[model samples]
Target: MGWWKKKKSRAVVKEQTWDRDQWRGEKILEALIQCCDGKPNSIKFFTADQILKATQKHFCKFVFPNYIFMGNGTLDNHRMILLRKMKGRSPHPPRDICTGPPKDVAISSMVSDHKNFMKLVGCCFEFEYPVIVYYGGERQYSPVDLNKIVSWRRRMKIAEEVATALAYLHVAFPRPFVYRNMGLKNILLDKNGVAKLNDLSYCVSIPKGETHVKLTWAGKDYDYMDNDYIFNRVVSEKTDVFGFGVFMQKLLTGEENFEELCGWKNWREKNKFPKWLSSYMGEGRMGEIVDPKMVLEEEERCLMEAFLVLSERCIGLRGEVPKMVEVAKELRRSLKQGE
Candidate 1:
């Protein structure tokens, strides 16, 4: 409400041009007035062309799928939410959504109740396109945030927070919650620098005591998911664990596609560990597997090495990875050790 309460005249009534390529904070403010004809009392979800119309009177946000063009442009300059819908890919039926993972309905069901998830603010019934709004505004961004290099300490914090969030999903609800999309890009960073797991479109709750949930469709980002889940057409919390492993590995290596970067394009058949990581781990060349773009201090090196091993385990590198709770504890310890 603080965002809505302001001098009425301060928000001018006029048409303006919105240049995305050349839009600054204030430019967005000016254009927002034209877009939201109802200003303070009436700030709500606008369609892509509607967003584009405020400026060009034509361009559309749908032109770019899986893209963030900046709607966090509020008067306070605080980041609002990155609006999106159905992050999953095509070739799947609607009912499959119920079996695949949690969708907009699942997330909207948790908005007032769950803090770990990004809230579902608006809905479109005809298109089944539910609006996802991360209230962090300017303060929140994807965890990868376009591969911006972060310190081991910060990453460790992210690891702990994410692990805790996952554990919450798996155990908090009356039933076990399985986050089908657990990729790095889906996780977000909030104003407090806390890690927030977003994109519940693929999340689902399996009956307690039931080992797995059957699915006819595979979620998005094939590379980041557990092959067992896809091939077996069955999923459980462990499926999320597998995806988390790939996610962590991606975060560590900073590679857009791990299998491609490691020359293991056929890894699906072989299921071998990445040659670069296996070689470097044994040789004690921590620097090799670690992101080349990142520089770590001496003390941080030990923690990073330890962190890598834990990451490998999470992905089932050594046979079996510990549950998320245990993983969270390990990450928390590492954070304390750094402090």
Candidate 2:
């Protein structure tokens, strides 16, 4: 090949490599890890000079609307980044990534401890790939085995972790944090089988509003539906209490039909949640409503019953959703007695 042609080809390759390195920042890398099955084998790192070359072409792609996934497994592990990169054309800009309507400013403003919980050691970056890193517990055994061991004990542990996290969200902080999307995927477990909450992206601050009030329906199909209760004012702490009640039912009965069961339609038709759960609990048949994997001792049956009753009251009571402090207190008492 001619010298000029060979030189041009080599330059192109260098640019590609440089571009990949620049995109490997923390925000993109975090997203990549969320979607990855497991950690990569190794990752790349770069100096600031190389970072410019690597990010120039691909940076604009993610600036305002078009978000990019950094550690998508498609990228070679050697080129991942551990820190968040800038998407703006300006050399210096305030944190521009999380641009959205600040409805939940209270929740969003908290200094998230995610970075500390999973302490990042180092990272590599690439344009079309996730920035890789050597994180805390990086060499630890993956929790792949835990997913296989579904027992009563494990399920209860999961339930407690979720409940505690939800309780914290509902009451522990000075201000309430509303997690709009609470799901199994958003729950994380440590090496010790203890669970914690993750993914606060959709979390928002509860707006000022009344308790157990109806909201306005934004859709047209609900013409006949009661407009007073369908949709109206903003959600508050009580709304979270209701969500936790539904979540408790999901954990207990192992049901995935929370919307159908707790919706206005069913709730209106049969407002006997407390009575129904109480009947089941009184019969020592908490298992009937609980996940089959969770096995409770006969002695612990009453504790489970209390929890169920509280959950029922959570939804059944209109103006008086029990405070998280009280709820935790009751749960503590029940668990203590059971133990």
Candidate 3:
């Protein structure tokens, strides 16, 4: 009886595994059809064995937040970053096929041609959720590295690259996408110090002929979100602009108490800079407000002032925020002026 019971239990487990695999396979196939014009060959597909071997069964020591692991690819022998979906329940459950890992795989493949965007190598669909692979040699930026980034020029370059990527997403496609998540954490620095924008899990496309799309708030960071999104549940290209403004603020201030300084409390009523920060900008005290790590020269003072003004526009403190393309152009002009 004990032997029969054990056999039955093993059979049940096998059946469950097979069922899960089948569901995942169908979902992936549907996504590929919808996103890739029914062309499976558009993006490479790695076998489960290949991915496991590359990642050493998820035992790799180099791990980033959100289950991203660094490993050497078995096929190409090149460093790769493997992004796996979390195992447990998600904070925001998938409401449609447009959400989650499948969308990430599709979008990453579609935007791989852009230099500022992360290059998608392939994906493995053997697991319940697909494992995404990207060519590595890039390091993710973190809040801890604020002081380490001493050069204002380097920070400006990163900001420009990220803005260019966002602009590409906005105009490159027939349907413009809003990059809802735009923080320092999603910016990666390559070996040559080029910034690559990553993590499109929160990306959403506005319907054709529509300027904005309304969506349920799924963002994890409320501080980076704009007042219009928080109060009205609206999402548009302006949403990304607001997020970029917050990101630039962090880069400029390098304040450890970033949240306390420019948190929801500061912008809850109106989407504008806090009184303290506004005062510094109004008084033309660039030295006091800028990052202490960055030493401004006589000529660089004007450049810093221009950057702050641009950031203000992005935050909508000015009359009207400029489009992402305009923002990118402004940053490029600033870079040239510095040179």
Candidate 4:
């Protein structure tokens, strides 16, 4: 009886291993089907062993918080960013259980030509979901590390680059994709201090002939989402503009939670600027609103004021918001004037 029980236990272990292998194979096939635009060769597939070896088996080097790790690849000898998707979590519908990583891979591959966008190096499908790989940078830019980005001029440059990338997403493809998530967390800085926009999990496309698509909010926080999107579920380029406005405010004030600004809680009812911003602007105290950590020269004050004005326009009412292309042009002009 003891010998028979041991044989049954070994059979169960072998069966579990086979089930895992089968699941991995199915997920890899699904990712390939979804992301294989005419140029399937654009996405390279790495084995699970390769990813583990690159990440030092235990993922010792932390890049971004929780999910992302930095590693030196054994096969290619290149530095890489490994993005691991956590298991047993379903943020979308049942049909979309394992779609986020593949969707991000597809969008990253599509925008690979752009300089300000994160470059997708490859992916591994040895787990329940795919593990994405991208070209790594020195570090990620976050609100906590505001001291690292101390110059208003540098902030404007980063803003301009991000705006340009958003504009490209709007017009460079057959169908326009709305980047529903835009914040400091999604912005990465390379070794050369150039900002790269990443994390396209929430990116959605507008159907042909449609100006906007209705989508349930997939982000973890509502602070940066536009009123139109939060209330109506409507997603368009304007949605991105509104989020960009919030991002710019964070960049300017160095505040992680911009909603804490005075009268912000009531601004939705009043449909106007927050009391703190309004009072500061009325008093001509731009210095008070700008990030204290930033060292702004006399000439750069005017540039900051212009940037704030543009940001306000972005978060303004439906008819008042400027398109991303116009925003990009305005930011470029401001950068040139500051120079």
**What lDDT does each candidate get?**
0.56, 0.42, 0.70, 0.68
Best-fitting candidate, measured by TM-score?
3
Could you tell me how far off, in angstroms, the CA of residue 298 lies in candidate 3 after the best superposition? 3.4
Candidate 1 error regions (>4 Å) = 1-82, 87-102, 111-115, 126-129, 134-143, 268-276
Off by over 4 Å in 4: 1-41, 67-71, 77-98, 137-144, 216-218, 262-276, 317-319
Candidate 2 error regions (>4 Å): 1-154, 170-174, 207-230, 256-287, 317-319
Per-residue lDDT of candidate 4, residues 218-245 (tens digit)? 4545657776787888788998988888
lDDT string for model 3 (22-110, tens) is 65556556655665555444567776667656766554544455455454444445665645443432424366334666666677877
Over the stretch 1-339, how does candidate 1's per-residue lDDT look in tens digits? 111112432123121122211222232233333222333321234443333333232213331345343442321234343545444433133455352222443344443245556654442221223233434344534455525655766767777878888887776656676787776666766667777776655666686679788888775466656668867768888887777766666667776545555654566557664443544676666666676666678788888778778877876777776887788788889889988
For every candidate structure, what is the RMSD over all alpha carbons to the true structure, in angstroms? 11.2, 11.8, 5.3, 6.0
lDDT of 1 at 230: 64
> Which stretches in model 3 have alpha-carbon errors above 4 Å?
1-17, 29-41, 58-60, 67-72, 76-93, 96-98, 137-144, 255-257, 263-276
TM-score of each: 0.69, 0.51, 0.82, 0.81
Point to the candidate with the largest lDDT.
3
> Residue 89, candidate 2: how far off, in angstroms?
22
Order the candidate numbers by lDDT, best to worst. Answer: 3, 4, 1, 2
Worst 10 residues of 1 by lDDT: 13-22
- Tell me the TM-score of model 4: 0.81
- Angstrom error at residue 206, model 4: 0.3
